[model samples]
Target: MSLPALSPYHLSLALTLPGLLLLWRNLRFRFYASRRARKIPHAQERVLILGASSGVGRSVAHVYVKRGAKVCIVGRRRDKLDDVARECRAMARGGAQVLMVKADCADPEEMVSLRERLEEEWQGLDTVIITAGVSALRPMMSNAGVEMDPRHPPKSQATAEGLTHAISVSNAAITGNFTGPLVSALSLIPLLTLTSRSPSILLLSSAAAVIPAPTRALYAATKAASLLLYQALAIEHPQIAFTFFLAGTIEGDFRASAVDKALPPNLTSSGSGSDSSEPTPLVREANPAKHGLKVGWVAQRCAQAVDRGEKNVFTPMYMRFGHLFYWIVPAYVEWRARVKYRYT
Candidate 1:
């Protein structure tokens, strides 16, 4: 039924609204899919994790262990990695091998070493989940050392191998996490059994990435750059999915020591850190892997997303809307976040 001829503005709105609606619905469906998959059983596969000793990485290790996936734990903390491996062994169904390889994520050579080690044992790697990352929360304004510089920053840090930790992690997501993982899963593609032809590279970006935080310049820049790269990669490869998980304000141990000491009671309800009202010591949210996202929760949802072969995931729900807000009301968002977090 033809009603009336639409103006350019009307046509624009009409075209735009539906597209926005479709995107909203699609994201909503995936979110629900992730929620539902939480209820089902996890399918087992061999897994390797970086920064496997603590936080979300460790939690993911625990989740996979329960599912009978043999896990290889990698981190600088040999003892902690060993402990996690021992625990996984006790919980194994098929009795998974927990190879504790001590390598620094900041050092590319160390990472290369770890890869070589993997090659030595396994014919091929099934999955590699990298949760190894570090952050400095000293508002990035001052070169205040929130995190001490290790004499030798691991492969996760800027390694002697000429790769910055940011580059290794983000660029790795582009090549290995997204593209490489898909090709590796080719065997399962025929069955669409273990995982669909739809391979996925799930990355942990931040809410600060979308909405620029003053002190998080480098961290945000790196994450933003990687996020865009994923979009391009996804466009080029439709069959393989590129998933970026934009994690939001999760209170965890990784907050800068001084900031952690200043959080108010309401913010630090658990009595772990200080409140926002206090003077912020550091700026960029340290050891993002340490806190912010619930380790077990993220692990569970990650498994769910892996199982469903979903494309993208932005957690805490606010992030989906945030993508819109950051575009439309960026200044206000920045102002509020600064005031709210009380960045000096």
Candidate 2:
């Protein structure tokens, strides 16, 4: 479709298509998002979750299974992934059909293999949620294995993808979560229209992206870029409902300590949590809590939000600040984040 250029009237009309498309698409997914799950009670539809062995992904799997949805879990650890799969079967009412894909979500070749398997088995899924990420306790400088740090100065721990560790994770999600899954599923939109009620896509992004995590240099950058990527994609393809769940500083394995203790005097007793080895002023480390969810609490909250057809999804109540911070005062928000979390 070609159109004239430099015409005020034409330019004005050009702007109308996106807005109109968004409205129409939102209305469509309004009915389309949850229809299949709600419609097929006994024989629940399958939900494919990448990084489901732990964290929010596992919680989401259990949540859907409880409400009678079959779940497929994919993650790096076969044993851990299987454990989650077993748990899904235990909790699932209709008897969850849990499948495990034991491959790093960051590997393109493995992803290709997965795509083939999925194409054969399920073809298209009703819901796809991507919550895969990587973070390190110390900077490249601190690690002894590679001298990529200022003190040590060694090079080369790159992946076959020819990207850094952080980049590979982000690339896989972009390809698998946004590019592969979104395209593959939307490719079957015709099929979706015929079968399911509502087909929605949920993407998990960090509040750190908007806030700017200096320690997690590459990780934060890609996440920040991805947030915009989804926003633009949402505008482009409004017919498909896209929900970006901005999660907060979750209080679990992501937090580790001698013992779970109270927050500093400043934080509220209920909302705040503490840990000894997580991103502290001097160092950072990955604790299991990074994958921790209040399990059913957060999952059920998300399920209800999807049911109500809400656009923005946040886990804790405070994350509503993400909207105001990301949209209204991104610069200040980022500046403040840098002060609080980085270069200490």
Candidate 3:
């Protein structure tokens, strides 16, 4: 085949193509931003946050309080919830109220009580954020030891049969990572719908929902399931905004607790044994700040998404590449993921 002559016009066009595309991309992004710039009226908003005592949820509460919204923080511990409420109250603008409710979302009775409390206190909810979740880092069959608080009874005291029962109990608790949040959302739907402001439900899910995560198969499945649930809910309920956050790593004890709680009781270790005496190392304890966004920063982005009525939120926006890449070439992405996130 005969080739065309190398011309100055071709060279100039080729040289400018990259810059032209870059300019177009930037302009498109600016247009989207300008459209999302409408201010979210926060005055009189009644927001209820699950897992709000710590981590990203806690930070979200602070953001809402600052924007002059009545905020309720829920967690497992009363003391921790109280501390969070105090912090939010201090940051609140105008007369925004902060309520601390110590309730485990996994417990049906607690969720019901939470509903009653919200109805009594705020009368209705403007925003409901479900951030309560536990990590499933270890394999399903692994005999990772159960977490024992010094203040509570040690798992070492339980008999073999009792240990088996405890394991069963622990597995149920692990299931709460999904069930609890689901119940919380359903229980508060009526209140959320009745809000004076634009009602929204924000679910803080992990990027693991879409990306393959080794040694975290169960965790990934649960997250993916949650996203699917809300995506459907969004379709069914057009009047309400259902936003799902496919978030990356952030600073928190969620990983630690997940590892601790999901672990089976150590069968071999007992009192006076050297193995039992030493401290047990957690599954994966690396500084999230070194690898991912800060908790407070991610929370602010989430709040902004609510303000903008965005249906899907991705933190450290670069994560969109992985999602896009996986869909384009699943095999290639999976192969790379296996090598990059090899099971330990």
Candidate 4:
């Protein structure tokens, strides 16, 4: 059976509809942006940023510091936190306070103590930005060949060791990417709800959460968990504003500290080195000439999204189409992802 070809009217409609929809979306975004710009400035607002010692967290701290916000930066490394605090203070406007705290976001007791400290010092909290997450660049089945039988797993010494290492790496990703942010949010939401009129929480998520990609199974799963956690929180708390910043690849050394120990060091720009109490060089340095978006620009966009109370923000703008594209063409998306991530 032969089918009739599409008419010119149908082809024209197919081409024109997308353009009209895009124009409508742009207008709507501009309308909301203008409204948000007129809101109260961040001057004197209390903000707490987790994982602020490096990467996007540090950049976000700079953004809020310039806006004259009382910023508290938290991270496990005290030396790095101090360096960030110093930078924030230097950039502070209108006496913006920069407090550096050494703590792990996955620790409940530490989060409690942090909440108490904020209450004591700042009286309340207005914003909380969570950017503490580890990256994974290895496939999920990288070590599966060592122990194929689930019923008789870890039969040999080599297999046992391999499995143990793989599990540890997976645990690190979950703890850093999901559990840590969940703990921090649970501890701080109460204070935010009680204190601020327009409480905001910005989560530095990744586009991988929605778009599947090779070598990103663990990373995407954990990030998706965190994203959904915040989305649920948004539904439960109507007064608080939540912004999930789903960013694409940024020009930085973030891969240096990936949880996947099996990944070759050469694949990353540089190694962060072993953990030390002393002040060591920062791992996540930004390179403007590198591929992808700039860290500073992404940070500014995150801040703007929080101010506007936007539910989801996709950087590079075009990343918003990724989900739809993947839905329409799964094989092509998978192939592109493999090529981009350098996975076979």
Highest TM-score against the true fold, candidate: 4
All-Cα superposition RMSD per candidate: 11.2, 11.9, 7.3, 7.5
Compute the lDDT for candidate 4.
0.79
Per residue, candidate 3 scores C-alpha lDDT tens digits across 1-344 of 99887699998999999999979866765654344333234666778899987888889998989988888889997888888888887788988888888888888898899888888887767788888887766433333333343334554444565457446644654565667767776787776666544677889998888887655666787788778878887887787777889887776667765633433334433332233454333344356657757888888888777655677777668678888999898887777665545432
The positional error of residue 254 in candidate 1, measured at the CA in angstroms, is: 2.3
The RMSD (Cα, Å) of candidate 4 is 7.5
Candidate 1 lDDT by residue in tens digits, 161-248: 2223333433433442233323322322222223322234455556666767765655565556656665675677565444566777
Q: Write the per-residue lDDT of candidate 2 for residues 86-164, one digit (tens) a residue.
A: 8888887766677778865656677667656666776656666766554433332222222232223233343332224
Ranking under lDDT, best-scoring first? 4, 3, 2, 1
Output the lDDT of residue 318, model 3: 66
List, residue by residue over 158-216, the lDDT tens digit for candidate 4: 34545566677889999999999999989999999898867889999999999987667
Q: lDDT score, residue 223, model 2?
A: 59
Per-model TM against the reference: 0.62, 0.62, 0.75, 0.81
Clashes of 1: 24
Worst 10 residues of 1 by lDDT: 263-272
**CA lDDT of every candidate:** 0.55, 0.57, 0.72, 0.79
Candidate 1 lDDT for residue 160: 31
